[model samples]
Target: MQLTQFTDLGLRVVMYLAAAAPDSSPSTKRVAEQLQLSYAHTTKVVARLSELGVVTTRRGRGGGLTITELGRGASVGWLTRQLEGDGEVVACEGDKPCPLREGCSLRGALRRAQESFYAALDSVTVADLTRAPTRTVLLDLTRPAV
Candidate 1:
């Protein structure tokens, strides 16, 4: 299954946060700039992530965005599910429904394939994504004066 760009960005945001100091709490603009992403789009992503309880936002001084413990420990598969929603792998029914929807084996196969894809990621936590090579890269990317 192809994950949406939104889900990709959400994962990037979570991974970046997981790599950061707990108290750093960089602002959205800072994150957007550091990540080389659009501020407006990043804002929307951050809002959704906040709603999902993976990120927390604070206003005024000494406040920005922080990843919750849930965000840190969550499996990539679980987080992806939250970001992806409960949409089916294939749209069997719609205004223009698939002709083979009535008895299609494809839909079930696709669903199972999607599940397997997610299952493969279940072993990796968000924190694990930032470890070693990726950890060093992310740390360099997030450093000030970058």
Candidate 2:
């Protein structure tokens, strides 16, 4: 199952925050620039992360984002599940309803497969994803250019 760009960017934002210095809080714009992404996209991702309680954001001067302990310790699978939400793998029924909406074995199989995918990641954490080289690179992004 493919993750939406929003979910992908959210993971990156969380990783970046996890790798940042303990006392550092980078602004949304700064994060966007560092991540080489559009400021608007970054802002949206940040807002979602904040709402999820994984990251905190403030406004105005010195206002920036910091990952909460929940963010640091959160399992990759759990976070992805939260970001991805509880939506079915396929729309199944929408403006153009599926003929098999009544009873579809494929839909149930897909749901189980999706859950398996997430469960596979349950053992990994954001810290695990940001370890070593990744952590180093993300940490460097928070540093002022010299």
Best by lDDT: 2
Candidate 2 Cα RMSD (Å): 1.2
Query: Per-residue lDDT for 34-127 in model 1, tens only?
Result: 8988899899999999998999999999889999998899999999988898899888898999999988899889889989999999999998
Question: Which residues of candidate 2, in runs, are more than 4 Å off?
Answer: none
Clashing pairs in 2: none
How far in Å is the alpha carbon of 108 misplaced in model 2?
0.5
Scored against the true structure, residue 11 in model 1 reaches a CA lDDT of: 93
Instruction: Write down the lDDT of every candidate, Cα atoms only.
Output: 0.90, 0.90
lDDT (Cα) of model 2: 0.90
TM-score of 1: 0.94
